[model samples]
Target: MSTSVLQWNLFLLVSSRKEFFYMDIELPASLKLTLSIVNSIPIIISMFGFLGNGKVIHLLGFHIEKNPFTTCTLNLSIADFGVFTSFLHTIGYIDQVDTIVYIYLLVTYFFLFMYNTGQYLLTAISMERCVSVIFPLWHRCHRPPHFSTLVCATIWITSFLLTVICIIIVIFRVTTKPLFYLLLMNAILCLPLMTVSTLVLFIKVCFRSQQRNKGKALTAILLALLFFLFLAFPFTFYVSYCYYFPHLHSLMLIGFGCSSVNSSINPIIYFLVGRRGRKSPSRVSMRAAISRVFKDVGDCTEDKKSRTESKVMI
Candidate 1:
């Protein structure tokens, strides 16, 4: 079955003529390599951060804390990492014309879909934050950590199911019309949600005096949303064109390249304008308090052991 799938993917790659290798305008190989390396930076940083701090934080039971922002950001980083890795594989196979290359392309398609879904999830997170800030009372009643987790889980599961459905549809139908429809549906559904979330975030930032310093935060979200929109819009249009006019294969290839840029931009935005770089003294103090609590627990445990030994000796 795996070999059959691989063969089918390779057939798709060869027959479609829209693989990433062939471009209309000549781009220097060195420039392409440079761009690919630059784009991979965000994925690298986010993967490391997500793997490093994310696990430690979760192990410390901090995942259940009242910080929806942190939890959502962590999940976003993981999703970004997934998107990045997938795109990196695609980039690596840009010149290859083999079954393995097609497999990488197939994986890239899956991750592109995943990346779109992740954008929606991130927008949902922003909406949750907006509600919490703008409607604090209602947010308290409705948007607790458990509620957020449930929503996040639902987004993930729904995305996975949807991706599976898309793959099944593609495999069975094998027609361009369905692909166009699928891409259009995804774009129409996601773009508006992202736009609204970005707007709400902006409004929330503007209204809240305390959050005025969060201009950078608002900008980051806006930039990320714009990045997504820019990448997705062209891909959607290219897919539509491919359905109607298959000769425009080079356009499709370029669109994929542009879309690859989206996966690499989120972590850079976060690092530059998001929470990681903006850690205030209050956050440091909170970390210190947590460390102290752990130390106190250890000291109590040691004291209990010592007392038990003394009692036994007596």
Candidate 2:
């Protein structure tokens, strides 16, 4: 959901033959303490995300809704749970955790899995959005119902399998190509899809009067994507460039810290946007509100299931 800039804390570890040792870079004492406090902020947001998304999932139950938008949002919420919890461990709280060598590496690898899975998932959502806008008829008529689920499954499985394989390689003294590829994959996959999503939104949806109903809704999504792109830029650049100038590591950490702000802001967006007045049609549930916003120009079917059940207070 945050479009996942990994903690960049991997640079903080050294995999020795028997064990992985930590190499702490000493920033100023005040800076470290400030970071610790700042770092705790995401946990609050993460909790909100977990519960907020959890509520949406509960409303849907075992049934998959017709909206791929809801499907992607659900997956994103699941990823957020992983992102938030794993994220907590990598922050200033690291020293407090039990750090048995293999255990620590497993945790590290799991964090990698969650973060990258989220990033890939966001890209998947972007690609889907692009297709929905560009070829609405095809999306509604020909697109497989399970396509979003499949995309989510692909992201999760690939992220997990690749992370485990890469961790095994790192732990057993194999080539570092896995790590290289991990960074490369993160850098490459997201931007193109996001760019297309944004371009398509601005070009086709933003200015068109016929799309008025979906405009606010689509704009909400686009704003989030744009914010993520803005936040992701320096961090992505640092991930590539830090290989040469290691001093940039600190800057990356700062960039990472700023990037985490997205986690906090996201749930706020949903809550704020989903809010409704006393006399409004219904209390805004994420699914119903989004489905309402995205009600297409030509399609007549509204997601009435969500609209009727939309008693969710926030």
Candidate 3:
């Protein structure tokens, strides 16, 4: 779950080729100590991330105004929290004890589901913002009030079904091929969609638009997307590649470390973006900062303003 389930399956498959099992693979004492130290770093970092995400969830869900973007962010924080919680399982430690392995597998299923749901929700957030910018009139006049909530619910359901199907495939057929393709499909579909949507927002809103304010909201979204693409994507690509070259198993810790950083960085991004122009960072409360990020005119007000400005110019 924290790592790919496919990675575990491939590890089992690799035992057929070489002595890859933890009990079988012999390492020097120094290397084992180094790996153990490196592994602990993520756990410490993830604890901070878990706390930060919890704070974000509390503020966004309870304190901020209810808008589509805030709704998306609240869910995003929950997903990140789940990621850190599930990462607590020591899947890397292969014990002869069956109880530990069973626990790891159980946690893995939920991890995959949450990770996939987060990816889809992020894509939806970016795409929705881009559309509102590109087609302002349509966005104001025709968009449903609860559209974001509906999309998020749909994403959760779809992710659950897909993860269940993957588990079923492994249980019955004992192959990793289905899960591998599923990961490949997610990377192929969601990443490009996010990239394109984010790019459009930058070009239209940041580079060329005539809005009086770019606002902390858009700034927060842009920063978050940038961090995810740079920090988390290494792990995403690594899992896809590791299936073929299981010899690169040594780098798995590094990959997970990158992901943990990505998972934990969003709250910091929001705070910094929201703290802009303030005389002192400590003076700005978290609730005030987050509210500034989610502040935007209502659909009707924005549409009316647009029409009035157009008539005056003409």
Candidate 4:
């Protein structure tokens, strides 16, 4: 859709040229009040997420041994921060006197990029865990230096490029059909892979006796992925609704907020798991949590590798 088409749509939506997307969105007084109260959460959560993830990343880099897993996590933190910053922009625009639809489009795609990046990283994390366990010898011997880093770079670049394309789509005002197909492609490409990988990881964690009682790392991953799925499900649902039931389009504030909360809550989950079953104060608390999660699972893998005929890398 071109600017002219959007302008026409805008004109059709409201006689006053200034009114944009949300102006026509019907909301009950109760819903409005709910939104007003709930709207304040993302910023606070985003702020805390940024600081907490920063601390975790710092600890990982300087104190903990770098690995494929840690590298993916570092990228996850960066992506979460990107989502946070995008939320900040979105809230800034939505709270304004006159919200420009174009700003919304840009911020929406930014959020999409961050969200998609996280999805890929989640898939990578699961596959990495699976690979490490299933192919310990080959993984220890054959995996190349900086290979994981390259994979992370590819994930980031792919997501960023798709985001740019999305932005271009909106900025150029492409037609409704193209928009639907783009979103449909996302539904097809991203969500199913996420579900399958999560399921596979969960199975590997649960049914494999060797993995049982291994540190709580898998437990933590399962929890984060489940909680994130609960919160993030609505956005995918909404995308389909937009394509199939266009006339029924409604921006459910609570659902959108929950999706943002997925990113905001991750650092906290990492902190909790890192510090799980411990009691300590401020600075001392974070002192070694980074090493613990990595090392707990490390001991389990080490025990298994102890019996292997092939030599393993340190």
Candidate 5:
């Protein structure tokens, strides 16, 4: 009887352990499915918009006068797609997920890296606009479309290389301390560049008050900087904490979720704030103005016909 009781207790313990492992696996799969659905919606919407407009061509093919806003939207869409796809492959399919995750991780990281570079590219576009507005002669002479294209290409290439290096580092399972150090270095570098771009924009606004449009431009750039700061800081903090305390791995995972929110927030910011037009003509007012112009033209033609009839009567 004593042996039977001991055997029963061991069996229960083993069953409980298996149940716990299964629960752990299922919970993450559920979460990943939820997250993928949420992330995928915006990506799908953006893709539809990109295709509905002619923006898809500019993104996939080379064009001399590539629309900057469309290009930015494309980059954002691609990044979100990568994030969603990676999450699905890595988190949703856990049993055979490792190899898929590795590949998807590289894909996701490449998109993120490119998105960051695209942010800088946007800053460059904004600065170019400001310079063109303020110094038309100089901008006309120096800012060639081909040069801009080359710069964008270089930015994409460099970003891809950097991301590849990071992926390699991750694959090798580099020490946490080194990863933390690397993240810190990147954050440090990004901060100064973001700050300088912000400061330059501010000075342009303050000194070039003649160009009253600077306010909107300044606000857009500042919003981009804020998005970067918000997205990056939590991830950096989590990484630092993980480096110091290995037991807080769960917190690091949560922090990663917070960081991922940045990918979604960025395009939202651009769509909402960056796309606003000048206040002079509201949509309604613009339509009314067009109607009035057509009405006046009709009236003028009628008047001319009536005068011609009167002259013929005379």
Candidate 6:
């Protein structure tokens, strides 16, 4: 039967790969060419990603004043930069998959580590905004000054550890179970938290609040979160699924391209949102525009305290 023939071919294919993690299944010439082209696009996109996120990093890391939201933004930019740089490995290996398969696998997981960290930071940013909006007075008065710094540090360390474990498992030919569960856990934890928190912020700021200045920082957060959900989440979910079911690994190129765009677009989102309401087309500098975004959000939170103190004095 045709089914029996297909089973035999599958068995022979797996047997020859030797390295289970490599999963070197054969591809048609046209399909290979398509994947090669797809993979090359991310390499090109990484240039723009580097420039955009680099400016963000330079601005937030040095020039901008330290605040909780700015702390998260700085870390997210670093993670985005990491993802962009990791794509550089694809430069020489687009058509050939024989010799550097192990290196390829390591770089792939590294990309995941960087991207997962971004997702965690995004969730944190959203939740912080939501809480500040929902409980403005308490958040303003009692929230710890170093909270965002602590959270971002923890996320980077944890993601790095998990990624090391994943690479080790892949190297040693252990079961792929850990990779699947890690991805699954990220999906379970990050996706829902980001969704709910974003929704809360949107409803409260856009519809319920009477305030005229809802803050461009929050607008930037909403745009970044939506981009991740639509553009990046698909690749995350797909790669996780493919790890469990190796036959579906052919779409890796397409997924990376999608995620590359997601990583590349955040800087533009910040610039556009930050530039809102500015009448002068050429007067606003990048630093000025970005400063307004974070400054406006800080003002929103601190304005109540200032007003209260003035009332008491009066």
Please say which candidate is ahead in lDDT: 2 or 5: 2
Q: Give, for candidate 2, the lowest lDDT window spanning 10 residues.
A: 1-10
Residue 80 lDDT in candidate 4: 78
RMSD after Cα superposition, model 1: 10.7
Question: Can you write out model 1's per-residue Cα lDDT over 196-250, one digit (the tens) per residue?
Answer: 8767776665576763343554556666677877775686777567556655556
C-alpha TM-score for every candidate: 0.62, 0.74, 0.83, 0.74, 0.55, 0.82
By TM-score, the best candidate is 3
**Model 4 TM-score on a 0 to 1 scale:** 0.74
Residue-wise C-alpha lDDT for candidate 2, range 1-314, written one tens digit per residue: 11122233432344323333643334466655666665566666566656665655554445434465666666766765665566655553444333433444555567567667766777777777777778866665566756778888888888888888887776676764465567677778677778878888777655686845555546656766776677754555665665556555566665554445554445445545444322564666666654454344213224333433574533
Model 1 error, position 45 (Å): 12
Report the poorest 10 consecutive residues by lDDT, candidate 1: 1-10
| Candidate 4 lDDT | 0.63
* Models sorted by lDDT, best on top: 6, 3, 4, 2, 1, 5
Candidate 6 Cα misplacement greater than 4 A, ranges? 1-36, 93-97, 208-210, 243-250, 300-314
lDDT of 4 by residue, 131-239 (tens): 7656767776667757779999999998888767755554455543433465567667766765765786687777766644354566566766777677876666664
Per-candidate local distance difference test: 0.55, 0.58, 0.71, 0.63, 0.47, 0.73
Regions more than 4 Å wrong, model 5: 1-77, 88-91, 94-140, 169-178, 203-210, 213-217, 250-254, 274-314
Model 3 TM-score?
A: 0.83
Q: Pick the candidate with the highest lDDT.
A: 6
TM-score of 1: 0.62
Model 6, 233-285: lDDT tens digits are 88766666555565654455456667889999988988887777878846878
Against the true structure, candidate 5 reaches a TM-score of 0.55
> On residues 197-261, what C-alpha lDDT tens digit does candidate 5 reach at each position?
66666676567656353354345555656665666457666656755675555655555555455
The whole-model C-alpha lDDT of candidate 1 against the native structure comes to: 0.55
